[model samples]
Target: MPAPPPHSAGIPASRRAQIGAGLSDSLGVGLGIFPLGIALGVLVVQAGLPWWVSPALAIGVFAGSVELLLVGMLAAATPLVTIAVTVLAVNFRHVFYALSFPITRVRPGLPRAYSVYAMVDEAYATYALMPAEKLSSARMVTGQLAMQLYWVGGGLLGVWVAGALPAPIEGFEFALVALFIVMTLDALRSKREVPSALLAGLAAAVALIAFPQQALLAALIMFTAGLALRYAVTRGAAHA
Candidate 1:
């Protein structure tokens, strides 16, 4: 007769090593955003905004694109509806991500909801790249926990240091834009990702031209169209 299956307790030593590696990968991914986080901190002070809000948003929202938008939106006194709509549209991809993430295999409960809430773009990317054989529940959770701490810690550090920086240093708001460009370029390097980005950009531009009041909505429409196109192409290839 066969022995009992290896439960969570029976995860091999090699698998444990993979979990440690995944955690490290998540940390390295988070480190890439340190400079940008610092820039956000400086901007918080320069914008005459409350510094405490930076870490709170990082802890709560943790969405980089929307956080940057909030900077300008705050100064413009953009309505709550606009902010809410924009953030939801920008992060709409997360809805799809939640469908297939391996962590779901781990059987999450209430703690899983909170963990899933903390799953930012970087975490998703790293977790998505994790090898199937190596993706254990222990490993996924460890990676996500490490990533969340790095993000929150970096933002907090930025907010604290922002208060002490000289006025002249506060002029680096462009760094935030530069960071977004870098991330965009990296993601768009692949042919598969390029179309989606181009579509989103075109939509944003068109919206800016035709419906400035609803630019976010227009971009979202384009994003939906792009995803639809991608799905059609994938299905065609599958049938071929």
Candidate 2:
């Protein structure tokens, strides 16, 4: 008889299927992530940082937008406190992401810790839209691992590519903005999310006008409050 299929050796078919689905789900987001990772690596090198910084940020920081910002900050020799605050402001949205992320599905221990550590935007968005019954620890962790691999691998490649270039590439910094725009557009695809998007725009405009010095933090606070109020009203109406 022929050798048994891979899944039949030890792993259950259901688990193997879940792992496959997870990796499959990561592909679409990985396309965007990999390119952005390349941009980040190129940025680190062009900023006069060591090549190792590329993969360092990819593996250590692992937050794309924050990593991009860190490159410029580190190049300018920004103060540690300033860097810390900026990172907190930029990544504070992750706190909100955690509210709805199905992290509890992951088993406790190293697996759960890794899942939490790797909970990037792409993973959050993917899990948010997935049906509950279809979710499993294997799928969620596998998908996140795949996305991170893409980012890490892309960063390494970018470092090499940047080294070969005779001159630095301009506008790699815009990659972070582009990534957010794509995410916003994807989120807005649902009709129900339109109101929230509008609220975010309004918050951003008001913050820019009234708190230009702290626009990002201000906008996040305003948008979060708006979401909370909207939720309360909707809940009340439902109960009424």
Candidate 3:
């Protein structure tokens, strides 16, 4: 497919549409992340943290789970060194993402570095929904940056909203859970990818059970195992 409009570089519509769609599409993943964001805001307010601090963390750190974890550590009066180390451990997957990212493909300079920083999992997933040719590295950077803005916007909004809410939102946080389950079911409606999905799910479950505390390690092991299984299947098919 050819490239999208110049204005639609990273996205596919007007600036308004770009922002709207980014916010809309991210609702599901945002839901999955919403509870955590709210919780982070609540904690920050309770801790008497400066308002600027939450936005800074959301922008600078940009990882949902890691931020939540860091807030938890802070709540416990954990040492800053320990909190920082734990944050690094939780986010080590980004190192792998950086290594695998098309370093040579993306343009060199501030844009590329900024893009790498903004490339969160939800943005990656959204990009995967687009065609490859339309997904220029520069466009990916643009899209990723847009998505980060949405994330930060949501978190900042949540911080203020959480402070004013009459009571906790409770189980409403499962909205994303339901959406993802639907998306998974929709994807699985076709029988072709079922085997791979099953294999990956089983591998992930086993890894999670075996490595409870090291989520990043478990995910890596599961991903490697799944890839190996795919490779073996392909080889067997070639011989057959």
Best by lDDT: 2
Q: Which stretches of candidate 2 lie over 4 Å from their true place?
A: 1-9, 174-240
lDDT of each: 0.73, 0.88, 0.63
**Better by TM-score, candidate 3 or 2:** 2
> Per-residue lDDT tens digits of candidate 1, residues 1-240?
999667477777777786787577776777776655666666766777888767777777887667766877776777788788778877888888776666664537854776587667877787776667766666677777777676667667877787776654744777767767897999889888887788878878888999898777667777677789888998999999
Model 1 deviation from native, Cα RMSD in Å: 6.2
Instruction: Tell me which residue pairs clash in candidate 1.
Output: none
lDDT measured at residue 33 in model 3 versus the true structure, 0 to 100 = 57
What does the lDDT read for residue 169 in candidate 3? Answer: 68
Clashes of 2: 0
Cα lDDT of model 3 by residue, 30-97, tens digit: 66555556555665655556556667788878876666555545555776665666566557667766
Writing each residue's lDDT as its tens digit, candidate 2 over 142-224 gives 99999999999998888988999998878766766776798799999999999999999999999999988666667878988
Residue 223, candidate 2: how far off, in angstroms? 11
**What TM-score does each of the candidates earn?**
0.73, 0.73, 0.55
How many angstroms is residue 172 displaced in model 2 relative to the true structure, after the best TM-score fit? Answer: 3.9
Sort by lDDT, best first. 2, 1, 3
In what order do the candidates fall by TM-score, top score first?
A: 2, 1, 3
In model 3, residue pairs whose N, Cα or C atoms come closer than 3 Å (at least 3 residues apart or on different chains), thus clashing, are: none
